[model samples]
Target: MQRQTLRLLSSTASIVFSVLATQASAQMFNSVQLHAAAPGQSGGMLGVAALSTPEYQGSAKNRKLIVPVVDYQWANGWFAGGSNGLGYNFSGDPKFHYGVRMTGDIGRKEKRAKLLRGLGDIDAKPEIGAFFTFNPGADTYFASSVRYGAGNDNKGMLFDLSAGFTESWNRNLSAGASLGASYANDNYMQSFFGISQVQSARSSHKIYTPKAGLKNTYVSAFVSYMINDRTSLSLIVTSDRLAGDAKSSPLSEKTRTSSIVAAAAYHF
Candidate 1:
């Protein structure tokens, strides 16, 4: 079973803890001026938010979900949480970092949408990858990551490249924006966008095969306001467009989708 509700709840708890830990650490150590200049919070932070995203790649329908955002970093570089999962920061310089990590692959479940019918469900699995970040200057960075599925459910490889900029407008207000793109291997394309003979027979769609190619591109922005040192509120907006074979798949309902997320994080 997917245990979607349980997963969301657990993730929420993790994000809350991370938020509190990070906020508390900052207030305890940094001066007010220094805090305002920082790019991101330190230590663990937890956040809870409602997210709206496509029910599946190419689907026009959207699903609103509650998610917990969690991130943590240790002095020695070993840490876990967020999309990066468990990893160690190998670079000694603050401007650059690289590390390997393992993250959970939350595959698609057919129950979420009608378009997924006849396409066999993909199981939750694991992926291992290496990530690198380069900070060109204060509040700006470029990053890339590549991962390969280590599980049977979706044994595919993916690569992502992105650029982001963050700024603190005032002591209590900060914002960031990012643009990114992704590439998927044949396995990934086939699993999510390809139509098997059985699926074609079962559904009203024709059999189709998608090859390896660019998958999607997206742009996102976020703003956060600190209510106090221990708590904050944030809103995020994102828009994405399916490309290559993914856009042509009969399984895909729309070429573009948008999402908004609102959340609060508490630091202890």
Candidate 2:
């Protein structure tokens, strides 16, 4: 019983440690990494996260949000909660993971800033994607994913690639860093960064059209600490720089964005 309990608690901490980052990163931790609880045991992390993120992918404006966290996965490799979205893991490899899921983005809203006054709202759209991840060692991992059906007409697409490493300083602490980039389709680029003729006439910005290319590159670092058997704390910082056509959008006031996240999670 004690062994199972420890496993359950450890599983909770593992999930908590990666939750917020995965929420913002559009990646999913493998089942072996996430569902570590003992057979028939239930230990999922739930908490709150505070974030300061760009209004849009390349927006210079930042917005703050506080949201609740909820996640629990069963033994069958199916789970749903918060930002990781609903998904199922079919891979049984301890070092490799692959799956399909539904993910989406909150499209830009004109009310987000005066700079967007002339640009109309880009309605949020649903996206479906497949993901693959490989853990070559206990401390290193590589992940990639492609999402489609984005944009107003569902013609946009996104591809994400990242690599990372984590070091466990002690039973109670772990730290890691990641480097990644995002690629977008022409439709996706235009949907968010392109300015239409009507928009140019209505807003202060001039008409501009963007092409599909690498949208941004980012670096992230994070540290997590277990406060107790059932609780954990984490802090993550990320900085993103717009690249290719994404950097030259006339609608963009800044080509770089940095964000911070802090949270505490508990297993119940």
Candidate 3:
């Protein structure tokens, strides 16, 4: 266990350094400009976190801080952009994950204007993008993810569609809920659901499979408060359900679990 923990830490640190180096050398394109209406236009965010789950319970502790960088450019009414994010969780259970995403717009300025007008009454605008994720602990408890989104408000997919809404009562209070489903690889499913092989030495059984299905469907809720313009706190809870052959695992009896996360984010 100690060796495994150390390995996880070392891998995470390597990924962080690589990402930082890449960002430091990144150059802005001629067409790129900051969004006038969005925060973090310079496209970077740093945060500290404390997260807890029923599986690992303890006080909030120090977690690695991170800054995500985004760059955007536009030409002939079309837009292109890319973003990179890094974060770490270090407390009861130590973990780190990061990824990059790219996006493109396929409409003319007039089309964009029409779309914005249609969504003006709505609180959220629609976006489409693809993302890739990496998890070094694929053989262990952590499973990485790569996903894509389309349609209005990042919704509408036959297998991985998701939809949600968020509202802020004031600068310090806000809440939102989301529901989504996706088809995942068996190994990834197993990792997320905490399924593993058990060995019984006395029984002479070389290996035994736990009876439980891996979870696939995900539901989540979140609330956040902004202490100030550059600093804010937030909490998130998520639940997942197992699916297919994975549900047959003995450990699948308890198909639901929740996690509570508290985080503070800063912009630079």
Candidate 4:
């Protein structure tokens, strides 16, 4: 009887060992898997195709164009003292995201008449007036202004309103859009549309009028990427649409216009 019991115990022990071995093999086959995360997670292979350019482009025709002398700003509250220009700011806080600016330009004596005549010569004296701007944030800005010129043929007032926005997605990439409109006396209106030969002749003025009339609209977009901490590149494009009396004028080209610019900036 004792011999029979020993045999049964040995058999049971062998069965238990086999079952344990099978489970160990199964666990090895079902090992945990590891995979790579998406590109943005590692700052590699970001899929933004547009930002992959080796060089930068923007609205200034890839040329290092400084902000025009006519639009330079002064102290945080006011911009003044550049060629008969004055500006005041009603709102000064950038963080709270609201402010207003008023700017004015006075007439100047040296009206490049010879150059002005080459375009569509309105031959007007310098103008003076104030513009009001409302900035809600770094992303959005709006403005309206009026000016009066002294020229016998050119003396008239202009009213203009414009708004624009900029957006950034990451530390190195950004985009922007803008729109604007304006109304003014016939001479000022013509000059705005690029039809007034006079304004175009003054390459220094860099002004254009819509052929359609005194009313004009413009739109623009731009994208920028920072290659590094000090160097960056950008691309910009813009379009203008004309309407009203200017469209019927001899200078009216009554068509959509566009421009592309690439630029690189070094931050000091």
Rank list by lDDT: 2, 1, 4, 3
lDDT of 3 by residue, 102-200 (tens): 322111111222212221121222332333222233222222333333222343211233444445555456666555545534432332222233313
What is the Cα-based TM-score of model 4?
Answer: 0.50
Candidate whose lDDT is highest = 2
- Residue-level lDDT of model 2, residues 63-131, one tens digit each, is 777777777766666656553456766766647767887766656678877778978888877778778
How many clashes does each candidate structure show, in the order listed?
Answer: 11, 0, 14, 30
Candidate models: Cα lDDT each: 0.62, 0.67, 0.33, 0.37
TM-score of 1: 0.82
Q: Give the TM-score of candidate 2.
A: 0.85
Model 4, 37-81: lDDT tens digits are: 111121101111121110111111112222211112333444332
- In model 3, the Cα lDDT at residue 233 comes to 61
Q: Model 3 misses residue 175 by how many Å?
A: 1.2
> Candidate 1's error at 101, in angstroms?
0.3
lDDT of 1 by residue, 57-104 (tens): 677776767766655566666667653467766766667768877765
Better of 1 and 4 by lDDT: 1
